[model samples]
Target: MGQQKTKKIEKEEPIKEEVKKPAEKIEEKKPEVKPAAKPKKAKAPRVRGQKWTAAKEKIGQKDYVIEEAIELAKSTNNAKFDASVEVHINFQLAKKSKEPIRGMVKLPHGTGKKLNVAIADDKLIEEITKTKKTPFDVLLAKTEDLAKLTKIAKILGPKGLMPSEKSGTLTADPKKTLEELNKGKISYKTDQFGILHQILGKISWDDKKLVENYQTMLSV
Candidate 1:
């Protein structure tokens, strides 16, 4: 027996199994949505009081003469205390003359209001600076005393009590001005819009008196 050729049995190597990874899933992005806006509410109508409604009814759509207007004003008045009868006059000025219309009016029957008039003097100035109180409504000054008033202009100017020649508050004779102011002398001037507002009288006055005042104001 020839020595069996030692055929070494060659061992076959085992094959390695490859692990497959699952394909990654792609996520689709969705757009974000917004909430809808709410609708706005409607506003309520203005409500008028019973007295105001009644008064409006009396003042119907019609142009009233001075006499009729005065009667209506008094009738429509509903104030607990006496109310003033006021007149608002609108002026159509020439385009060339836009200068403010100003002057004084002397009503035949004095305005029901009382005016406290004072003549500026050394004593009055001393009293005002010391007390810081303005006791008078209308101030009148003689020409000589006007220079002295500069000291207190800060106080009187704001109050419209400062004396000036244009307003006829500054004069050579204060006695005459006081006399005029005493006899229903009310000063008036147009606003920038050329409208004049004045108190004719109280609602309690008779129709004749109110009408007279209205006519007089119209004349101006």
Candidate 2:
């Protein structure tokens, strides 16, 4: 056995606990939003012609009956050129009435104006293209030709020159229809606002003729 060595004892160190820091307060940010605005309607342009101004002045604020309205419309003829007399009727519709009021009247004396007529047959399409200006006031087309006229609907619709079956302007025999139209066969319809507007006759027409025409329409 070798000589005995003295045994050394080492003490273990004590573990220290880490101190916890208080949690910091943070503020959340929110996004700002704005509401969209509504669009405004544009006002109709005022009439600038002097004669038209005079015509407006002739029209009274109060409503006029059929006879009196015809007289007023005649008096309002201040145009340098011959002006057609027009009657605008406002109706107090019943709350329950949803159907539109529509009818046609053939003036005995005629409207005293010649309507430029256009036959919308395939054979006549070439004739339409040749005209630089829209020379026709009334366009007559058969059911078969209506599809072809669709190409020019945008141009015709705005002018109220588009012939529709609803107006009885779209006929099977366009030639006969054209003759009747030329003889002052007027068609009218009430607008969305429940107002009816139509030409009575030319301002140059005799008062008796105007009255007769008005009475004929009223009877309808």
Q: Which candidate is the best by lDDT?
A: 1
Model 2 worst lDDT run, 10 consecutive residues: 125-134
> Candidate 2, residues 40-107: lDDT per residue as tens digits?
88888875988777777778488776678777866765568878887667775675676667755688
Output the number of the TM-score-best candidate. 1
List where candidate 2 sits over 4 angstroms from the true fold. 1-79, 94-100, 123-135, 150-159
Error of 1 at 217 (Å): 1.6
Cα lDDT listed for each candidate? 0.87, 0.75
TM-score of each: 0.72, 0.61
With a 3 Å backbone cut-off (N, CA, C), the pairs that clash in candidate 1 are none
Error of 1 at 115 (Å): 1.1
